[model samples]
Target: MKKNNNKLLGVVATVVMAIVSLIALFPIISIVLSSFIPSGSLMRNGISFSFPWDELTLSNYTYIFTQSAEYWTWYGNSLWISALMIVLSLFFSSMVGYALAMYDFKGSNIFFVAVVFILMVPFEILMLPLFRLMMDMMLIDTYLGVILPGIVAPVAVFFFRQYALGLPKELMDAARIDGSTEYGIFFKIMLPLMGPSLAAMAILQGLGSWNNFLWPLLVLRSNDMFTLPLGLATLLTPYGNNYDVLIAGSVMTIIPIVILFIFFQRYFISGLTVGGVKG
Candidate 1:
């Protein structure tokens, strides 16, 4: 009786999960199907439930890759910007987190409070002022202009500090007794243990930077400087149509992030779990 009940529960759980997965995947499946259909067919059918009766065409992809060098440039820019932001965020956030976790100093509570306070403030509110500051610095339409503001993210600091606080204090003291400098202890000892948090922070920062439309759109004037999201946005025709190409662009934009998440999914999951659990 007990064994039968357990088996029944497992079957029910599996069915429930499958349904949930289908619900989540429906939109992605629809987009991919839509991307394969001809532009004219898309206009005629208007996003059908049935699969494409027509053959899949590579034209959409080929058009972007070969015909439009601008698309590739935008893709490359998005990739590099996201990568750089992840690297810088890791370094700065780790240092800040470590200090907050390990150090006892003047106004430490006040500083931590301030960091948390900043996290509550939405980025949209600061855009105008931040843009003005970038203009004052003559950084508009520059890589440094877009990237510099990204480095000082408060959420990264918060995650790092929480993760670091959960680490053993004795490890730091042991390093100190071994004639290790503060920086040495942090770099060589603490950072290795911070892999999960860093991985989590990297994914978050990378995704945020990659998908950032508004900030890049505002700062980048020329079409040459546009990132993936910005470039994808430009695909919208003046008539508010071009579903096939738009879907193709969306797919192109999504592919890199999907590949990244798949490769680092284990690390990402572990990082998120640890950061949340420890905090």
Candidate 2:
């Protein structure tokens, strides 16, 4: 009886998970399928069960890569911005996390609380003010304008702090005993050991920077400086439609993030888990 019940439960769990997986995959499947459909067919018949899968074409992708110089330019811009954001966020967040984790000083609790407060504060609330500040500093329309703001996200600092908390204090103490300077210990010892956390932070920050649309849209007026998301938006004209190109652009935007996740999935999961556990 016990063995039969266990088998039944496993079957039920498998069915449930299978259903959930399909539910999660439905939208992605729909997008990829839609991207290959001819623009004329898509207009004649909206995405439906009867939509002809046999008449798939690769023109959307070809047009995006070859015909659209703007798409490639924007893709390059997004990559550079994301790279800069990841580097800066990792450095600043790790240093801040180390300080919060290792230092013992007055108002430490207050400082931690402030970091938490930043997590609670919505970006929408700061958007206008930050834009104004950027205008004053003449950062508007510059790559630095977009890249600088995301370099020290509260979430990044919070994740770093959580992972840092798990580090053994004896290592730092030993480094100090060896007469290693504080900077030396941080760069040489602490940073190396914090790879998992940093990798995790990099993925998060990179995704955020890459997908950042609103801020970049607000700050960047020049076509040359537009990121992937913003440039893709331009592919859709105000009065008319370009479904094929639009879908192609969307696919282009998703490819990098999907590749990043595939490569660093382990670190991403570990970092997220550690952050959740600590927080």
How many clashing pairs per prediction, in order? 0, 0
Q: What is the RMSD of candidate 2?
A: 2.1
lDDT tens digits, residue span 98-177, model 1 = 89888999999999898768878998999999999999999999999999988997777878888888999999899899
* TM-scores for candidates 1 onward, in order: 0.88, 0.91
Residue-level lDDT tens digits of model 2 in 109-219: 999898777778888999999999999999999998988887767777777777788889899889899999999989999899999888887877777788888999999
- Model 2 gets an lDDT of 0.82
Q: In model 1, where is the ten-residue run with the lowest total lDDT? A: 270-279
Indicate the residue-level lDDT of 223 in model 2: 91
Q: Model 1: what TM-score? A: 0.88
CA lDDT for candidate 1? 0.82
